[model samples]
Target: MNDTQSVNATSSNDTMLVTKQVHEIEQFETFGGDIIKNVRVGWESYGELNDDKSNVILITHYFTGTSHAAGKYHPDDEEPGYWDSIIGPNKAIDTNRFFVISVDSLVNINAYDENVITTGPASINPDTGKPYGLSFPVVTMRDFVNVQKSVLASLGINKLYAVAGPSMGSMQAIEWASAYPDMVPRLISVIGTVKADGWTTATLEQWTTPIRLDKNWRGGAYYDQPPENFPNEGLAAALALVTQSALAPNFFNDVNAQLLAQADGKPDLYDIQQSPVIVQWLMERARGRTTSMDANHLLYLVRANQLFLTGMNDDIEQGLANIKAKTLFIPATQDQLLMPYHLERARDMLKANDKEVELVYLEGDLGHLEGLSGIAIHSETIRAFLAD
Candidate 1:
C-alpha cells in the first residue's frame, strides 16, 4: 500500500477531508470557582486510532484558531487550517502513525467562524436564553485544559502520546502535563511558555484597549443590537493590534514595500487623519477577520491569557516540578510578543526540577507567529521528538 493508504487520510494528493464533531458537558467547573452549565465545544480528528489508543495526539490551538487543525471541509477551498503545513500523511505529524485531535477552546476568538463550535460570551446562556456576553465566567488556560480532559475522557482515551500546540496552545499543552502528568507522556510547546509573567500579562491586556474604548461595545451588551451597531470597528482595531503583535517587523518588510518607499510614494504631510500604508493594510486585514468574531470574546481571551500561571495557582515552581512528560519547546528566534526568553525561563524552571527538556529555535522573521506559519521549518525535529 502507498503511504496515504496506510494512514486514515483520504489521498496522497495531501488534501484530506475531515468533519467537525461536538462534545458536551452538563456542568463544567472553571478553575476560577465559577460553574458553567450545558457547555459544548467543537472538535475534529485526523488519522487512525490504535487498538490500545496509545498513539493519540491532542493539538490545542492558539488564541485565534479553531479545531480545524488540518484538511479542508470542502474540496475547492482556497486555504486549509492554520497548521496544515506540518500535519498530514508522511508529514511531520504523520497521520499515518498517530491519531491527531484538535478542539476549540471555550471563548475561542474564532467563535463566529462557521467551522468553529465553542461556548463563549457569544453563546446563549441556557439559564437566561440570552447570549452570555459579559456574564460568561472568566476562563483561564487551565480551564481550557480541563475542558479538553473531559473531551478525551468521552472518547475512552485516558492516556496521550503527546499534547502539542503553538502560542496559547503551548499554554494548554503545559497545563495538560501539569494537571495530568501521568496521562501525557510527551509535551510540545511551540512559541509557548510555562507561565504568564508580569510583563507578558500586561502586554496581553493592551489588546483589549480598543475594544473597550468603542462606545458601541456598550459594555459587551451589544449582542442584541442591530448588526451595524455591533462593535465591528472596535473589534477590527483590536484584532489589528493582535495582528501587529503576532508578526515580526521583518516579516512585514518582506511582504510589503519598505516604509521609506511608502513615505515617498504617498504624502503623509497633508492629512492628519490619514494612517501609514502599513498600518492601514493591517487594519483592513483585521477588519475582514473580525467581521465574524465577537468583541466580548476577544476581551475574554485576553483576560484568560493574563490569568495563565503554569498550574493556575501560586508557586509556579511547584507546578513546574509537577510535570512528568518529556518536554520540547520551539520558540521563534525573532519573536517580539512572547519573546524567546519565555522559553528560556520555562527551560530553567524545568531543569531545576530535573525534568527531561530540550529547546529549539524556530528560525524565522515572523516573530511570534513563526510557530504558527513556520512550523514546517522544524517538522523533522518534532517527528524525531515524538518518535523518541
Candidate 2:
C-alpha cells in the first residue's frame, strides 16, 4: 500500500476530527443567470487559532480531491497524515509554526463529504426541493475565491501567511493572490496556469463531453432515471484524459511493469484500481456536477486561467507592477496539462514586475503529476519561502 493508504488505515492516532459543520453563507446571482441560494461552506483547521490568528496558511486542494488533506478521521486510528511529508511538526509547512487550513472547492467532484459544504447541480435547491442538476448557476475561479474569502472572514482571518495549491487548486491560488493582493503575501503555484489556454479549455470541454453526450445524462437530469449509457462511458473517457493530463509520460508503463513483477508472472490484478478497467467507477464519482455551474462558470474559470498575463505591463518600460507577493512557480518539465513553457512565462512576468519569483522545473516523468511527486524534491525551498 502507498504511504497514504497505510496512514488512512490508522488516521485517528495523529489527527483531530472536528465536528464537520456546515455554514450557510449568502445567495449569489451567478454569471450564468442562475441564482445560487444559501451557499454552504465546510472547513477544518489543523492547528490552534493563535492569540494573534496571524499564523494561518490556506492550502487549497486539487481537482478530484477531497477536503481530507491528512491525518485520521478519528482520534484512535493509527495512520500518520495525508500531506505528512510536507505538513506537520518540522515538516515543510510545519504545523508547529503555521495553522494550515484546507478547503473543498465549490461543485468539485469530491464535494459530497459532510465536511464539504458546496453548491452545484447535484445539490438540493431550497426553492425547488430538487437537485439543481443543470439549473444551478455557473461559477468561476474568482467566485470560488470570493466564497473562500467569506469563509475566512467568518473565521475572522483578515490576512493570510500564504495561499498554496497544485493543478486546479493552483489556479485558485494565483487568482487569490492577484484578486486579494493585500491579503496573501506568499504564494506557491504548482503545475497550473493563471489562465487555461485554448488547448486546456478544449481538454476540459472534452472531459465533460463524454458524460454530457451519454443518453443517461437525460439533459443533465439523470438522477432518478439514468439512461443505459449512464454517461459512465463518458466519465471513463474523461478519466482517461485526466490520467493522461495529470501523470507524466510512461508512468502507466512503469506501473504496469511493477504490477506484473508483483504478480510474479501469474494473473496480475494489481493496479486495476488505476487502470482503464475502473472507468465506470471513476465516472460515477464525477456524475451530476452542479447544473448552476453552467457553461459560463467553466468558460469564466477557463478565461481566468487563460488570461493570466501576470508580468506583462501595458508598457514594457513599466516592468512587472501588479504582483505583490513572493511567488514560487514550480511546474513539471513533462507536464501535459499545463506545459513547462507557462512557468517560464510566469517567471519572466514576475521578474519584470520586480517581484521575488523562483521557477523550479520539477524533473520527473510524472508529467503533471510532478506537482505532487516533485513536492519532496523541493520541499526545502518551499519551507524556506514560508519561513521568509
Each candidate: RMSD to true structure?
A: 3.9, 7.1
Query: Which candidate leads in TM-score?
Result: 1
Reference-based TM-score of each model:
0.95, 0.80
Least lDDT summed over 10 consecutive residues: which range in candidate 1? 1-10
How accurate locally is residue 269 in candidate 1, as Cα lDDT from 0 to 100? Answer: 50
Model 1, residue pairs in steric clash: none
Candidate 2, backbone clash total: 27
| lDDT (Cα, 0-100) at 110 in candidate 2 | 41
Per-residue lDDT, model 2, residue 287, is: 49
| Residue lDDT tens for model 1, 1-388 | 0011132345436698887777888899998889999888888888888999899999999988888889888888888888889888888898998899888999988777888888999889999999999999999998898888887787778999999999999999999999889998899999988777898888888889888999999989998898788888888988988888899988888656765575557647578998868777788899888767888988998898888888776878878888999999999989988999998999988988889999999887889988988999898899899886
Tens-digit lDDT track of model 2 for 99-197: 777765677564334445666666788998987776766566666677777767767789999998888778778778876788989999988776655
lDDT, candidate 1, at 337: 84
Off by over 4 Å in 1: 1-9, 255-267
